[model samples]
Target: MLSAGPTPRVSLDTWEFVIAAENGTEHRWSWQELMALPQETPMVDIHCVTHWSKLGTTWQGVSLDTLLDGVDTGAHFALAHSYGGYTTNLPLDDLRGGRAWVAHTFDGAPLAPEHGGPARLLVPHLYFWKSAKWVRGIRLKTMDEPGFWETAGYHDYGDPWREQRYQGD
Candidate 1:
């Protein structure tokens, strides 16, 4: 379990995730709103840059494609921001289609705070760090911007299969 800062206490009544785009368009969704969307349980393997891998983990949440539906943007990349100020960057392509999810449940139960509770971005195909925990929003941009770890020496695009961990790995 890794965290950027103290865990945030969120209330279902006031908590909402905001998606902001460079075009000045922003969309907000509450917990109930998100749950109302089509959900899926995907069994995926997660690899951490710290040299650990967890396979066949099941997660349930709304697909990024679903949340992004009708959102028009020419951005080529996205920056995932978390409650505790953690952020990660990825190509917009990595989040489209069925490639990513905003997961709220794990192993058939509500996600625990220690594991990025309320909701977390799950991009299983990339290194686990790219799956920003405590995810709160996504900012789309036309140009690439290195995120927290990326600016701190981690690779800007963390593709696990390619072992892109460090800046030049």
Candidate 2:
């Protein structure tokens, strides 16, 4: 059985996509430093490889392009580091595409813990696992790598469009 927790709220700040998250299964970020990731455009649908398609969910966070702005991500790749050491890897090019975002709010409301609020990587193009929950920081690498799901049987490239969900990858 599961229980519901308090609802989350979107911060007025967060335009630059900057956020401060803590170690939590639900969406929980510190108050003093934490702020709802700012508003964004060009939102999209979410397709979970688990056979669930949560559509038209609005989110506000920094776009991959905006986050990587000014910072040199070298030429390797990127890794999303989450609480409890969960991680996911991606090609530098894909991360640079700007489709991905660090979501703090959902559907015009604050993100609930079950929804990966406070800070969750929102990569609508990839499978849900690629969007690591309880996300903390992003480490851009120099190679197309894999993370917890990728190492397990999930696809290395979790492209929802291509239906790439498993390790035959």
Candidate 3:
């Protein structure tokens, strides 16, 4: 396990995982399946919307890059399907550079719910909400669709370093 700093044992705070579809197809993932998916580990930092950055978070999960490797979506956009009907969209190219991952474990252990456990999308370059909690699946789309936060006036592509938090940019 290659890590940059002190790695803490991650934990999911004993809560059930919720997985639902935006198209009304409901499916809840079990703890077993969350643990069974193939894993690609990368040590990263998290930038929360509340204006704090947590560094050196070791995460292990199925990389969207790896999962979508051979599959030909031939589409430009995609939606991150999550629990509670929450979703965020992104361009397919943004998923490159190891920045996008479907993370299950953080710091050598299962991710805690407060930290977006069971499964969450880790788009490290964007705001934390984009790192959604309870991720079920991703819907690859040809047209761009905004998500919960985006509809609430947040930036469509939340680039934190530039303070892209609102819709102006």
Candidate 4:
């Protein structure tokens, strides 16, 4: 598992996930509330910006589509925020459909903190960095906003297939 800093030991009692819309509306879900939502097991391939690829990894979580079902938003971009202040940007479209999940289980086991336990944003189609770990919320944005890595020269839209690892790549 890769992380930007020391693993954060999060307590379930205080864990919550949120979705902030461009209109200033915030939808929140506590750990229990989140687990009560519909769950899906997705087997997908993940690629890292470092050029490593893992195929057919299994995970269990709620689909982002399910989470955004009734969310009213006109935003075309999204900025994912995570615990420990890590963040990443993605086109809102990339998070819809069945493309992404807020994963809490891996290989049928509770995800380890080092692996973004509690929950993490899983966008398998993009580079792994685009999948923010320990994801707490996503802010819908009318304008594309770059996040942690993006601001530090990483590609704003990281697509592993396109080799978009750097700002100009």
Candidate 5:
């Protein structure tokens, strides 16, 4: 299991997932609320920037499309924020159209805290780090903004197949 630092302890009854728009609008969903939405089981291959690849991983959660349904925004990018002060930026296109999910389960079990429990952003098409753990919300932006790792020299847009690991890679 991978974690940013010490695992965060969350209480199911009080935790929530939020989605904020560039227009100053915000939507919040509790764990039960998210579970009530449409859920999908996606089988994906995850490649870590650190050079490890895990194939055929199964995840179940609400699609990002479903989560953003009916929300209006002219943003071209999204910055996913996590509870542990971790963030990752992705093009809005990468997050929509069934490309990503707010995943809560993995391998037929609830996601472990060390692996980002409660809910995490799952963008399978990009390197695993783009899938921010302990995800709490997404902030829409009309302009791209470098996130935590990106500002730390990781590639702003991490496409594993292209091996975009570092800033100049």
Candidate 6:
């Protein structure tokens, strides 16, 4: 588990996941509420921009589709925010249609803090960096907002299969 900043230990009591729309409306889910949502176990292949890959890994969580149900948004982009201030951007379409999850378990066990415990965004179709660790919320925007690594010269959309790593790659 690689993180750009110090790992944050989030207390479950205060943990919450939010979806803020471009229109300023918000949907909030506390840890308990989130756990009560329908859970799915997805075994997928994850790739990292750093040239590593994990195949058929199992994860348990609510689908982004399920989480976004009833959310009203006219946005075309999404920025994932994490507990440690880490963020990543992705096209809104990339987050829907069963493409992503707010994952809390791995390998049949609670995810360790070192591995982005509490919860993380798991978008296995994209490079792992797009899967924000310790994910706290998602901000829907009408405009594209390049995130932390994107501003640091990493490709705005890191696709391992296409090898979109560096800004010019």
Query: Residue by residue across 14-133, what tens digits does model 1's lDDT show?
Result: 768888888999999998999999999989999999899999999999999998898888899999998878988999999998989999999999998879878999999999989988
Listed per model in order, the count of residue pairs whose N, CA or C atoms clash below 3 Å is: 0, 9, 1, 0, 0, 0
Per-residue accuracy of model 4 over 129-162 as CA lDDT, tens digit each: 8998899999999999999989989998988888
Computed on alpha carbons, the lDDT of every model, listed in order, comes to: 0.90, 0.64, 0.69, 0.93, 0.90, 0.93
Compared with the true structure, model 4 gives a TM-score of 0.98
Q: What tens digits encode model 2's per-residue C-alpha lDDT throughout 1-169?
A: 0112343333335312222212211223343334433447546888887788887777777676765555643456667776556778776566667778777677777666666656678888777777766567776555566788778777887888888988774
For model 5, the stretches where C-alpha displacement exceeds 4 angstroms are: none
Error of 6 at 58 (Å): 0.3
Candidates 1 and 2: which is better by TM-score? Answer: 1
Each candidate's TM vs. the true structure?
Answer: 0.97, 0.74, 0.76, 0.98, 0.96, 0.97
Better of 2 and 5 by lDDT: 5
For model 2, what is the error of residue 94's alpha carbon versus the real structure, in angstroms, after optimal superposition? Answer: 1.7
| TM-score pick, better of 1 and 4 | 4
For residues 29-101, could you state the per-residue lDDT of candidate 6 as single tens digits?
9999999999999999999887789999999999999988999998999999999899999999999999899
Name model 4 segments beyond 4 Å from true.
none
* Models, CA RMSD each: 1.0, 7.0, 7.4, 1.0, 1.2, 1.0
- Candidate 5 residue-wise lDDT at 10: 76
- What is the C-alpha local distance difference test score of candidate 4? 0.93
Per residue, candidate 5 scores C-alpha lDDT tens digits across 19-57 of: 899999999999889899999999999999888999999
Off by over 4 Å in 3: 1-38
